[model samples]
Target: MAFSSGSTGGPMANINVTPLVDVMLVLLIIFMMTAPMMSYPIDIDLPQRSLNPPQNLKDPPPPISLRIDASGQVYWNNSPTPISALRNMMETEVQRDVNNQPTLEIDVNEDADYGLLAKVLASAKNAQMQKIGFVKK
Candidate 1:
């Protein structure tokens, strides 16, 4: 809030929200005042719980490390893998357990090729990978 003793008002460029805030406050007070006075009596009958055995929950599969080196070579779990096989690999991993697909965590070298990265992402997208993450270093 700015208050000036000297008046130099020549078509103010800054917006003054005092009136808007005052209106909003009045509306809020009105709503608050009226909200508690108009409550209608209603009954809610809650349902009883039925006895049943809880289903077993399966733990999620581990995340797979997908690394890319500066030379544009790809690695699946530290083993050399070709870019041509990326789509198939992603599909296989995803299909391994349909309910819970393993997340692919990419850890790439700083000098890794951007084109290869794009291709990898494209393959992942094509294979409909549910989760893909990036790992630092």
Candidate 2:
């Protein structure tokens, strides 16, 4: 706090901010000194290499293309496939290893039956197919 150097000295209307700025700078310095100590990263213990590594790590199987036409007819890889066979196909595909489960890409026409689409999705889920996907076209 400071008063004006005038003939009739009184309380100053404006505040002195130098002390406030000094205090803020001291607080900033204290935080800067302590921030690194507060943020020590948690250590991660990794598993040692297994004696038997994975065998025959070939590429994953190719994706299967499924298309549903406006008339509710299903096509498996561009060939006409009955809806009843979807389950058997899905089950056989899911027999692959988890990482090798082929992606089922389904393309549904705009006017396709929603019931058929739901049935297909339900079948995939029932078979525990991990990588069923829908195509835009």
Candidate 3:
């Protein structure tokens, strides 16, 4: 603490920020030293090769067409198929080609029941069918 020599004022009280700056610097250094040790390397078995090939290399399999009419009837490949058989049919197709799965193209009528469509989608998913698409028309 220093006293003012001027005759106007006695001793000026001022905040000493040097100690605060020193404490902040010490904390910053501590954090910097410990931050690197906090992170640990994790090991994971990542896939080395992509399962799918380039699109141009091979011809894609023909998509299986599934249609839902306004009367809530489901058709597989233009033939009437019962909802109960949908899962079996999809599983058969998957079993036929283990490497290449057939894509499913669904055509739902505008007036078709939403529940029917949902059921069909759920069935396809349950059978582990991945490539499902919707037709605009």
How do all models score by TM-score? 0.59, 0.57, 0.58
Encode model 1's per-residue lDDT on 1-137: one tens digit a residue.
Answer: 45555577444456789999999999999999999999998896565786974476578898989999999989999899899988999999988987679999999899998989999999998998978899996
Show where candidate 3 strays beyond 4 Å: 1-58
> Which 10 residues in a row give candidate 1 its minimum summed lDDT?
3-12
Backbone clash pairs in model 1 (N, Cα, C under 3 Å; residues 3+ apart or in different chains), count? 0
Off by over 4 Å in 1: 1-55
lDDT of model 3 at position 109 = 96
Runs in model 2 with CA error above 4 Å? 1-56
The 10-residue segment with the lowest total lDDT in model 3:
52-61
Error (Å) of candidate 2 at residue 106 is 0.6
What lDDT would candidate 2 get against the real structure?
0.90
Tens-place lDDT per residue, model 2, 35-106, is 988997888666688999889787879999999999999999999989899999989888867667999999
